[model samples]
Target: MSKVPDRFLGYAFCVGDVLLELDMDFHIISADGAIKNTLGAVNREQSFLDLLTESGRGLIESSVKMLTGANRLGPFVISVGQEGLAKTEFAVFLAKLPTAEDRIYMVLSKPYRLGKSDSKNAPAQKTEDKKREFFNRLEGLFEGNPDAAENMLVTVLEASAGQQLDDEKRLDIERYLQSFSVGGAHATQIADDKFAVVHDKTTPKKEAADIAAELARATGVTLKGATIDAAEAKLSETDSMRALIFSLQSFASGNEGFAVDQIQKNCSTLIGETTERVRAFREVLDEGRFSLVFQPIVDLKKATTHHFEALTRFELPPIIKTQWEMIRFAEDIGLIDEFDYAVVNLAIAKIRKMLKKGGSPGIAVNLSGRSLSNQGFIFELMSLLRGNKDLKQYLSLEITESAKIHDLDLLSEILDEIRGIGFKVYLDDFGAGAAGFQYLKKLKVDALKIDGAYIKDALTSKEDRAFLRSMVTLCKDLEIVTVGEWVETQEHANLLREMGVDYGQGYFFGKPSPNFLVAPTAAAS
Candidate 1:
């Protein structure tokens, strides 16, 4: 706590938005507003910066250096410290009082009310959905997808531009730049002015610079920026995620190659072990040793199979991994896309065969969101599916939210194209992620599979049941079907049906087996 000017105190008191006072070290001195209701309990001992996620922290840290004359910090579509909200964006405004230069003031504003217009009767929604789903999806993504681990080239580019453009145009350009993906690598905006590109090991340093240059031009201003490359770094086995994130933060701060050392530290064992696993995994993909299992999603009203979801099962010796564990490993090694293509091809072939039997039940094959991020993969998948467009009725695509899709708008467009070909698309594990609401807004899907966790808890927890009922009502309003998973008993099914879930799938229904009646895919469980 420090002395503050009376005029500044008066202004801070009158400000209706969430406000915070921070020392020069960015430690909280004071706080006001309903922040505790959303973000969490305010602890004055904590660094004000600690409240922010990595990217959000990076944005502030980057801006701090240029704050000498600037008072206003952002209207950046900045993600706040809060998790699991329907909308993650907050419009941030930061200022430094002329008389009290030792303290920085921040205000956070957003459309935060849940299903309300700020009336007297309106109440706040529970936070578990936002918190649990955020951590769950992040854990799912952090574990990696089905692929081998390899050295990667991570490059950070910090630019000076966009001051001349309007906020919407600037955000649009940022989104466009963030869409840059090569193979398994994707670009993420660490700071409003900084973009970090994670590229394949084969990507040259010069090539990474060129990517920065191209994106820099998209800012619609004469921007000059420096690119730093953390070339050929092996993330540490024990703390790979922390090391990776810290490295990005350092890069955003214009630190030298110090970022690489964090990841490279104690990574030798990881390198040797992963090399062998990568080899074994590649062989599995090549050998075509996987089998297909079909789990029927039953329509609640009709009590019949609406469609069957195709799942993968691996058959191998020694090293054992669950379906998702293998998928994450594959994603880590950057070979999941190849595995995805193989599965889709097999699915098409099977659909063609089923069509040969005169009357065919439709099959939905899971496609990793990571693969969809790659334009090359999307183009190839579209080409392959278009070639077998006649099987569109018998085949559907279920988007597995295994990885974040960088260009969601592009994906929505592609999904529309696929649906135009008469293939239904379903979003998997809906409401199991922080971005589900954003996803539902952007994507036009025929159906969504409610996360199994929600379904498992629905019968016991009134909160869970309430959320499901509300979700089901929203889906019905949108004219979209809903599927509940992990249904183990008749009671569960009945309750879900009463809540207006259109379909259901679980062990109570027949479990998945090699009922595809054909040779299975070349890769993965």
Candidate 2:
């Protein structure tokens, strides 16, 4: 690499700013006085990556890999200085050096200043902030005692269509929920498309049903709702809340078609198992007692592994025989996030090791709806992966059809943010849920996993086969890849390939294996 031009250096030095010269490997060969002062002797002859946080490193790494020209690296916010010391916020920027193809120049800007808030946007931001505050407050209302004398009934309402509810309709829904606010009953907008009503056991079932109907009638919007009464639930306060969350989610997704009594009964079953389930969940976490197996998704034409989907297996007591049962229990008890985090971390760690050894097929992990809804958890996850972002190219996140996305806009924003970080997002179980093709329109995703039910029954069921073929055609038109799930036979594989499906994942390819090296090479398990 050639040295930076004298004219550029002179200008950079004159600006009295932090500047450095870096090679393709990101090792700094020279540094200005500002950088020397800021870094205190470690400014030169080191990779600039050493100065960044994990997420910053990931962002820069990705940007650097994709560097085409004099690209700006970041206005990345960071707290600089040694740990436990007074730190300063700095925004770092990097540009590929024009003089040398394999070198770059960097500048650091300090002390972030806020720009003028747009008058129109200020109110929206405030409203969203207030909504978050209200959500937290409502969650706190049940914190003190699980066995309180009176039970609380939590009902959540969401629009059955559209990305958002208009201001007037939104207000009417909120007001209706509020009108039921007598004694312990209160309501709040929990999401852009979601509203919640919390009341004590005293509220009648008929009253709850009538209010839901009235809200839909008044707003002229079809709304879905789920009501869970804590008094009837056999769970602790925390577990009960999760039950309510999932119940609401189930309703919104059009998955739970049961009456209110059945819904409560189901939640009660989940609650009753909480203590034992929680103990088992924690034991798995504490002991690192879970294993992940990778199932290859084969490309029919190429006959090579495009990527592997990581499936987790827990070493639980004999009573818990199936993985799905354990996962459902984990979901019911609010431990799904922890469980997912553990599984993803393990999967990523294994992938990193595998990459170091050899090979580069991508891996996709299933992310629960609960995890997606929790913004804090999502950010932390991104931060964790930011340092090792090159792994992102081979990583994907699959959002299941059963995962209830109450706020389409929020989910879209989250998906876009994830994609921006260099990972692909696949819609799992597409065409099986109420949203169906509608989900694809609202949320732009890289691929869709055709609902397994359709694939499994397609051979004998003409309707299922037609749906599968149509979905494949639609996806091809949209330039989205389609993967046939539960493809357990040669006939299924051939049928999917004939329909132009890009990938196949099922027992037909190979069963999942903890050791990828030992995984089967045959097309059929």
Cα lDDT listed for each candidate: 0.61, 0.66
- For candidate 2, lDDT tens digit of each residue in 327-429? 8767654677787888878878888887788866688999877677777778877786676688888889998635445667788888898888888999888
The best candidate by TM-score is 2
Off by over 4 Å in 2: 1-138, 144-272, 318-321, 517-525
Q: Assess candidate 2 and give its TM-score to the true structure.
A: 0.56
Q: Which candidate should be chosen as best, given lDDT against the real structure?
A: 2
What lDDT tens digits, residue by residue, belong to model 1 across residues 280-389? 76678789878678987877766777778889887753563576667877665556788899888887777767767866678989988878867789889888878888
Candidates in order: C-alpha RMSD to true structure: 19.4, 18.9
Q: Given candidate 1, what's the lDDT at residue 315?
A: 70
Clashes of each: 14, 1
Model 1, position 207: C-alpha lDDT score: 53
